[model samples]
Target: MFFTPFFKMLLHKKYILYLRVFTSLVINRTFIPMTRRFLWLLTCCIVLLSACDKRMVTADNPPETNNPTTGAPPISDKKVQAGVQGIVTDANNDPLAGARVVCGDQNTITDQYGAFRFQEVNMTEAAAVVTVQKAGYFNGIRTFRVTAPGRDQFVQVQLLPKTTAGTFDATAGGVVAASNAQFIFVPNQVLDAANKPYKGQATLSYAFINPESNDFADIMPGDLRAVNDKNELVALQSFGMMALELQGATGEKLHPDGTNSVTFRMVIPATLRKTAPAVIPLWHFNESTGLWEQEGSAEKMGDSYVGTVKHFSFWNCDAQFPMVNFKAVFKDDKNNPLAYTAIQLTRNNNSSSYGYTDEAGEVSGLVPANEQVTISVKDQCGKIIFSKNAGPWSTDANAGTFNVSIDPDARLALSGKVTTCDGAAVTKGLVNIQVNGVHYETAIQNGNYATSILRCATGAATVVLNPIDETADKMSTSTFQLAPGNYTRDLQACDVIQVSTISLLLEGQTTTFTSPADSVLFTSYRSDTSTVSIYSLSAAQKTPGGLIRINIQLSGIQTGPSVSRYFTVAMNDGTYFSESLNITITRTGIAGEYLEGTFSGNVQKIPGNTTAPVSGSFKVRIE
Candidate 1:
């Protein structure tokens, strides 16, 4: 323990040197392997000495430290921290669950209640760019600020429904243009997915550019001119593609019905003939697929090409092809050429090209080509006179000649009078005529009506008379067949009738009866030509547990036999009532005073047409 001063000083100096060497080696990466053992020994000695020295560092001067493996930059802590919470909803305030809410780098999905919250979000700026999105809804964005920590900032967002904004209607018969390019927009039907009319306002536009024009340049919407009550715009330039945009057209609008339409007109410049000699093809830009799809071919209008569309979007016509002329001759059964006939060339998808035959029985026009094509000729009445499959058409070999003969006696004219079984015309009703499942509606006038249909050689044809009034009578239906010719028949439209079979053949005949069970008077009206008595019966009967009342009204003159509406109670002592049913009545003569008609559609407590058969006739004395 006791040592010389020189030896002790020497030992102290060596320890200091070892400590300095070990500390320097630990801090730097340049130490060699040869000094590794010696450095380890120095480190152990320094640790023991440090405990004895009791050394410490203040917070103001901390030791330097760094990561050992990655050599990456140190992460920085944000100075301000905040949170955001909100709900996403539709225009009606209905919650939109599973909506994606994004703010800065933090994103959270909405819960079932459409609520979303971001915890411990680091604020980057004064306002956070918050976005909310959901399927079938417009994307919503809001610039929101978070003032306080947790649960302080809240937002409620409402998204509108996307729908069609406008319609493009192409004119039916466009004016032929002599220019090379033409633009036309015809408003077809605008309807929702359910085929309802589109109620909201929409903006429609088109871009007309030469085929060589730049597609990147933007075209502003042109001024719209009102033609009558319709939205129409005459083309300001000869050509370019147009983009359509809609504003304030969200909510409940997707499809539109036929009543919604507009016509767009574009004038073809004189230079169009040299630039685009072929017909103009209509093009629609597909947003989903990012491609141009052909909608239909346009009809040539004077200095323009016109076409109709049911929606508003980017539309144009730049793609073109050469036109080819196809000639067809139409004739009758005896080889006699027909004039002014409509000839149609149809493709597989039902795209049609039409032309009219001239006095020489020849129809020649430029027609487009498709894979599977067919040619057909029709008379002026829209009845097909001849049909042939002309499929696998080539645009290269577009010109051809064909001769067709059709039977002239292939159509029929059907004329009839709708009356009740008692020979009274149904004046205040509609006659629904159906042939082969096709329906045509005609209003009943003067108890007489007429409708045309394709003559069917087999199966029965049906005629139904539906009254458009308030009465308890039933709808009347009749069934028959016809040959190719003009014919007239009297139809009886009424509910099922149950009555005593008595054919009275003379005039001035009267029949009266009183219900034994209900004490209701049934008085019949008669005509001088028939024995049928049109009766007026009304009664308040109490059966089936409730009191029921019936009423019928008629004041007129008649030429044919007439029958009265019977208030027949299907249940014992009970009557059916409806506010929308009516019976039939027909009158012929001076001032239509004599009355006759049949009755159907009765609201027996069930509130619909009854099958019960009832008939009657009545005559009012001429004063």
Candidate 2:
């Protein structure tokens, strides 16, 4: 079996060399900013320096700890307790939030700066795993061990952008072009927390409309009908990642190069959106006035406005949204109106419903007030897309007409900005706000952008900003609260230079013997027996996150008898907690170079559960 001393000796040498190589390549880790047009094109082409993976982890059985009082409170006679706080940044120095910080079952999210705190962590409870999650970025989870009582720890979470290995296989997924827009999906190679293949069923369908007919956005993608082993026809709005990629000309992705395949990896939030159906939000697109009008909410030609139940009602919107509008232009073979449509209402059971097509070729009516009701629309062939109780239609199927009155607490107004370090306004940045976890994303506009999307008590919601530069792993965040009215504040970027490394000298500066620098993550890991010191060069540190090339110097070595080996020192918090190194190492590289990796995790737990959640993470990457 491989031994620690031998591996350590080898890693010492590898780390030194990586620093020398990357430092000479770029002046700094930051990327040169680009305009939106070019930025979009760059994304469509290729992303640079990606080495990310999405790995999830869940812990039910807590690990055993050797400490006499690993999870015990400090109030006891002998154990002393102390507080901990710090910032967790990626290798690129970006603060990571929602990074799982656990002391047994307790956990917390990092603030804007990746900052966290464990009010009074006991040094005895020193085992932890920090999991990081941000949209468009790679997901990471790492384990660590605690060594002492009452101590503060620093951490780094090095993240790599979401990327695939090499070009995709034909069936993988790609971008598709429609009338005047493009769209793409996330990759579908998802694995569960246990690294097991997620075996769930899925359903998708949509109709093909001729663009010349002025149909809904020309061609649209369909929504999920059902998933899991069950073929139950789930509502399209219920699909999480399964939600239809809506608005072809205005989809979110940059639209990849060729038109072969595309991937999407998100889950729908049917639970949270339980009340967001069109049941109370019927809208009419008016061609004449260039507006969307609400049907029964307003008089035919009296007011050209559409009332939004959950938001500001057209009746109260002043000039923002109208209370009535128009529809019906496309003509079917029967001289009847034919157009794409959807519903966002609920159907009670034990009820039958029916209605006639208006001038707009659409129909509506209350389903019989039964335990379950089926409200459906007719397709071009006069065939049912699927009875409300039948199945979902391909391409699209909006929920039914809205008829309920919205409570006063639903609508809220919000505004914010995207700026640089110096406070200069930035136009190309994207900010996504999560209120009570409801998402409202917007950009700063051609010149600027902001919206009044309502949010709930999260007290203040989290604001995440993305740079227009495709290569930067930087993301900015802030927290704020809002009531029923207007609120404004400035948002800042918190993403840091987690691995802002640069070599100092010329070529041939590589060496042997991993140094502290090579071990960018100054962390302690725990195991049942002892604490293990992990390195980007060791197995303990290898994660799907970014890799920072660590360089080591050859201290000295003895010759003969010793065989070359490549192993790793990992933080095994599964069974127990121990601070310090239970040292494990490996010898990698054909000639004499090593490049493993590091991941994300918290520092507070490693010390003890007595403390709150510590704010710290680690980044592992290679040059």
Point to the candidate with the largest TM-score: 2
lDDT tens string, model 2, 88-164?
44534445543444432223345444554443333323223333445434333322222234333222333333432
The true-versus-predicted C-alpha distance at residue 246 of model 1, in Å, is: 29
Cα misplacement distance, residue 217 of candidate 2 (Å): 32
Among all windows of 10 consecutive residues in model 2, the one with the lowest summed lDDT is 314-323
Kindly list the per-residue Cα lDDT of model 1 for residues 150-186, writing each as its tens digit: 3224444555444333332211211111123222212
TM-score of predicted structure 2 = 0.23
**Scored by Cα lDDT, where does model 1 land?**
0.40
Clash count of each predicted structure: 89, 120
lDDT of 1 at 516: 27
Q: Which segments of candidate 2 are over 4 A away from where they belong?
A: 1-408, 421-424, 432-441, 451-477, 492-623
Off by over 4 Å in 1: 1-282, 285-410, 454-474, 481-484, 496-623
Error of 1 at 137 (Å): 29
